[model samples]
Target: MTTQEKRNLIKGLIFISPWIAGFLGFMLYPVVASFYYSLCEYNTLKPALFIGLWNYIDLLTDDIFWKSLWNTVYFALFALPLGQVVAIALAVLLNQRCVGRPIFRAIYFLPSLVPLVALAVIWLWIFNGEYGVLNHFLGWLRLKGPNWLGSTTWSKPALIIASLWTVGGAMIIYLASLQDVPRDLYESAELDGASGWHKFLYITLPLISPIIYFNVIIGVITTLQIFAVPYVMTGGGPARSTLFYTMYLYNNAFSFLRMGYASAMAWIMFVIILGATVIITRVSKSRVYYAGE
Candidate 1:
C-alpha cells in the first residue's frame, strides 16, 4: 500500500527470482506438461497425439499394470511395518547405556550408506543359490536355502530381506527420538513397579509416537516407489514376481517408449501416495502423541 512496502516487496522478489525461475522451469512446467502428455500419446520420437483418457482406461485393463500394482502393495504391506519394528527395536537397544554403543550404532548404520546399486549387487551374490554364504551357513544346520533370486516364490522375499539391511537410517531417527525422551519419565515408571515392557508401551512409545508417525508416512512413500534394488537384483524376473509399479513405469517410459502410458501410471501412483499419506494422517490423529499438546 505504501511506497517503502512496495520497494521492499520488489527487493525480496528480486532476491528470490532465481529460485522462482528454477521452480517454474524445472518443477512446475514438467508437472503441468506431464499431466497434459498423460492425456496424449507421447514418445520422444514423434509429436504427441491427444488421445483423451485412453491411457488411463488402458491401464485399468492392463494385466501387467495390475500385477505390478499388486507386487508394490504386497512389498509395502510387509516391508513398511517390518522395517519400522526392526528400526525401533534397534534404536531402543542402542539407546541403552552399554559398552561399545557407538561402535554398534555405526555398524548398524553403515549398510544404509552403501549405494543402492552396490547394495543390490552385494546382496545378489549373498543370495546366490549355490556356493553362497547364506546357503553355506544354512547347510551347517542341515537346512537348505531356497534359490532366492531364481525362485519366484523367494524373489520378493529376498528383495524384502535385502531391504531390511538399509533400515539403519530409520534406526538412527528412532534412536534420536528415544534419546530425547525425558529420563525422569522412565525413572518414575520404574518407581511405580512398571516392567521394561510396560514402560516401553506406556511411556516410551507414547512419547516417541510422533516420530513413529513421521517414519511410517515416509516409509509408505519410499517403499511404494522402490525401484533401484529390485531393478538391479531381480530385474523383475522369475515370472515377474518382483516387478514393482515404478519398474513397470520405467519400462513404459524408457524401454517401451510408451511415455503417455507411463505418465498416466505416474499420476496414478501420485494419487496412491497422496491417498495413503492422508489415510495415515487421519488414522494417526487419535494415536500420535505430541508433547505439550
Candidate 2:
C-alpha cells in the first residue's frame, strides 16, 4: 500500500479503537466467561468445578425450575402480543389529527416514564382487594373484584395488566411508522371509493407490517426477560405463580450461591430467545412489507 493509504488506515483504526476495546472487554469477555461457567459448579467464594451437563440435567427434575419456566412462558405468551396490540391501537388513535392530541399522547406516556419499582408499588395499591380503586369501582356495580396479586389464579394476569403501562414506548414507534405511510397511497385508495376500514385493511396494515414485525421481536425479548415489576410486586409469591425465570435465576445465583447453575439457566434463556427471534424473523419474511420488497 502507498504511504497515504497506510496512514489513513491507521487513523481510521485509531478512531474506532475505543469502541472495539469496549466491545471486547465488556461484551465479549463476559459472554465467554459465562459460557465457561455454565459448564461448571461454582460459588463466588470457591473455584468452579467442572460438572459437565449436570446443571442442565438437574433442571429437568427440579419442580421450581419447571414452575418458573412455566410462569415465564405464561407471561410471555400474553404480555408480548397484548402489549404490542394495545400499543398499535393507541398509536392509531394518537396519529389522527385532533385537538389536544399532544396532551393526550403525553398523558398516555406518563405512566411509562415512572420508575418501574415505583410503578409496581402504585399498582400494588391499585390492585389491593379490599379497599382498592378497582375493587371499590367493582363494588359500585355490585360486583366482586378478585384478589389480584394475592391469588395464584390471578397474580399472573395482574402482572400482565400492569405490563400495559409501558406501552407508551412501543406506541411512539408505531406512531412514527404510521406517519411514514405515503399520503398518495391513501389518496389513490380514496379514488377507488374505499371506506376507512378498507383503506386501513389494504394499505395501512400492509405498510405498517415492518413496524409490527420489529415490535413483535422487541416484545418477545422484553417479555421473556421480565423481572423487575413482578419481582417488586409479588416477589414470586401466591404459590410461586409469579416465579419468573429470571427471578429464579437470580435466587439461584445470589440467594442460594449457585452461580454456575444460574449461568446455565441464563444460557438456556439465551438459546430460547435466539430461537424465537429467528423464527419470528423468518416468518416475517413472507408478511412484512418494505419498499424494496
Query: Clash totals for all models, in order?
Result: 0, 0
lDDT of 2 by residue, 31-145 (tens): 9988888889989899999999999998889999999999999999998889988998999999899999999999988888999999999999989997678888889999899
TM-score of each: 0.98, 0.96
Candidates' lDDT values, in order? 0.95, 0.93
TM-score of 1: 0.98
Best model per lDDT: 1
Residue pairs with clashing backbones, model 1:
none
* RMSD to the hidden true structure, all candidates: 0.9, 1.4
Model 1, 126-146: lDDT tens digits are 999996788888999999999
Our model 1 lands, by Cα RMSD against the true structure, at 0.9
